[model samples]
Target: MLDDEARRALSRWTVGEPNAIREYAHGAINQTWLIETARGSYAFRRCAQGGAEVVRQNHRLIGEAVARGVPTVAPVVVEDGNTVVVESGRVYALFPFAAGVQVDRDRLSNNDIQAMGRSLADVLEALRGCDRSLVKEGRYEVCVSEAIREIDRLLSVISELPPGEPSDENALERLTTRRAWLVEHGVEDGDPFADFDRQPIHGEFQDRNLFLGDGKVSCIIDWDNASWSPPEWEVAPFLDFVAAYDKVKVAAFLAGYRARCKLPDERLDACVWAYGLYRAHDLWLFREVYDRRNDKARRFLTPGRFKPHFERWLRR
Candidate 1:
């Protein structure tokens, strides 16, 4: 959306003509753009229609993270130094361009992949230090309970999904059983361990949002989904790759994560099961909504191509 207003904002911030402008709204949520000014490139994000406070809190969190030595995009508050600027009824923030390469499966190495886990742990620890009281509370978009329930809903529709293979049916059944377990006995809040656990999160953590440079994680972009939530709850996305990549990669990730953040003994062993049923199921939903609909990758979703990769990822 490189309109006159956005260009004016860019000019006001950078104080120069933008050489180039790129729009990147690939995520299902929020609006994003990149502007290349004569001075430098800048990243821009406009909050979703219903999410003004979320972006405001995220701006506070970004500043807090910077103060704590964490890598993240800093929000450009309005002219008045407010975290968000409402223009034409849309909320937007401009940030200094981050330095790094977007991570992909092909570009990731054993160590490079493992580093992401460590980086996640660092983000968690730093987030803990931030004043959680400043973070707005209520209806966190990525809460575990709500996420698990959505997976259960997906499982209910699994069999009805165009009559796929028997294994697909079995996959849904296993996931459903797992969800039932969670609803029945898993921690439903009010535990000491749950202190920082259900605090805040980046919400969606994956290769897409991660960036690497100079042999280390330079920045973790896309703060629109950052919310108060659990710590390792951030790791679910990398664990989702089990359906497409080898277990060794997933292991490398967790090994790095454990080095920084340790899952409780009870949650550790079961976290792997989460490594399986619930997490796997949610990724499938993500794939249906994300990959299958992507204009560039739409053809990959034939009658039954992605399931085997999911199964194969699991066997490994």
Candidate 2:
């Protein structure tokens, strides 16, 4: 249920305010609405408190890229020349809906992986050229030492997981074995941050953020997690999805990435450990939440997703 006052304020704030019929696209920690206006169907997102800061950086990055002719969504500037407006204690901004196709599991490919790697490298390079202050830094750092600390957090969480929720027998063993192996072997020099290129990274540069059209990365969306971090961290997603089938695709992505940013072998090689534990914990976290819901996602509360995946990794 929305109101006229909210609509009028939004109209005064953005290009297509009045005739812009809006519908909820998502209503999570923040609110994202699809607004159809004379300007076109654009995305209007509202965030309060901490979200305001992130929206600022999101708009700044998009504006910077558009100004440089790099392909990205442009935030709509209001008649008052502000790209964002705060009204009734909420921060709101409108962005042109990014063009391209939604990526699906079946759409994964070596070419797509390589293209993803290349596009991230290109966008990072573009971001590096801007005034660094426009991008804000967060409290935590991504480093090998830091990664180990995060692993420790995951292990402690594992120890405290609800009694019946551990992985399936095979997956449980694989998780234990890999965790032990990583604890012993992964602490060496092969972290991606060693001599890494730094930037205002589109922090979550996974395939879901990629909008592909006609065989290229048409747009990267969802700046919710954008942060200033080593560009090498962008290597994780391409590695995670593709390494399930072709390790060579990860290799191709790295090769394409090197053409733009020269990363240390340590960081590139660390993709395996980084991606492995990342998926393990990420899947575990998803299960934790999904198990509490009534949706079909509850089917994943068991080891169905992890057993085969972990077994395959063990065979490799």
Candidate 3:
């Protein structure tokens, strides 16, 4: 529920009187509320992690993206000529409600996937042209020792927990399998993308962040994770999304992206490997479910979600 101080802060903008406010059930990090007002509906979000400066930086990137014809929701400016408001030690921002539906990965058609590919390329290219000074250099490499330690800690914790739901068993099995795989084949020596160029990329460009309508992408939301990284790092996830490693779908997505930006053929394999390693080392879902006991993160866990990426990496 929204507090009084936060509600009062809405008056600083000309979005009109709020009639209804409901918090969105999804999202792992930020607290987002749908506010229906007299003038129009808007999305009010509280920065759960970074402070006002982060919000301001995101707005600058979004502004640059909009100028380049990217389909994304821009933040609404308040009376004081700012896109963010700080009230009660919290950072908040408002955006006009984006009209579209979020489609799951399984339901997406080839056309939809191609549209997503094109949109993501546009976003990456737009951000690439922005002043590089706006963002800090993002990490493309991972520490194998730290990942091994974390996996060991998680395995120990899971072993001690009382017998619980089927999901707990699922987590235990998956973690054990991952531990063995990591031990045998984890990158320990060289930098992953030492030769590739880095640019601003939407770090999290998965299906959930995209909105679709009439089989086309209407908007690309959620810019909080935007940062500077190799362009292939952004394209790797889409390659994984193509069902059964279908070459046609992969070609369509690559063609769409190539129309807007350049992706060398030689770099394709490396891109896939980069994304594979990322998923291999990622333990956030486990930490959230087993450590923090967050129910929302549990939905992301599926049988063998991490194994496919590892297998892909092995094949490459």
Q: Of the candidates shown, which would achieve the greatest TM-score relative to the real structure?
A: 3
Mark the regions of model 3 whose C-alpha exceeds 4 Å error after superposition.
1-6, 213-216, 241-248, 291-293, 305-310, 313-316
Write candidate 3's Cα lDDT for 24-108 as tens digits: 8778878789899889999898877588987898889888878877788899999889999999888889999886988777777
Whole-model lDDT, model 2: 0.60
Number of the top lDDT candidate: 3
Task: Estimate, for each residue in 1-316, the C-alpha lDDT of model 2 and write its tens digit.
Answer: 2465456556765464445555654333455677666767777766643656667777787778767655678777889877777777677777778899766645677777777777878888877767666666632323345444554554555565566655433334444554555565543444334444457777777776678877778988766666666665666655555454355765667777777777776655554444554444333333343343323333433443223233344454
lDDT of 2 at 163: 62
The per-model lDDT (C-alpha) reads 0.62, 0.60, 0.78
Q: State, as a TM-score between 0 and 1, how close model 2 is to the true structure.
A: 0.67
lDDT of 1 by residue, 110-181 (tens): 788788888888888877756766565423222348657766665665655677555455546556655665
Model 1 clashes, total count:
5
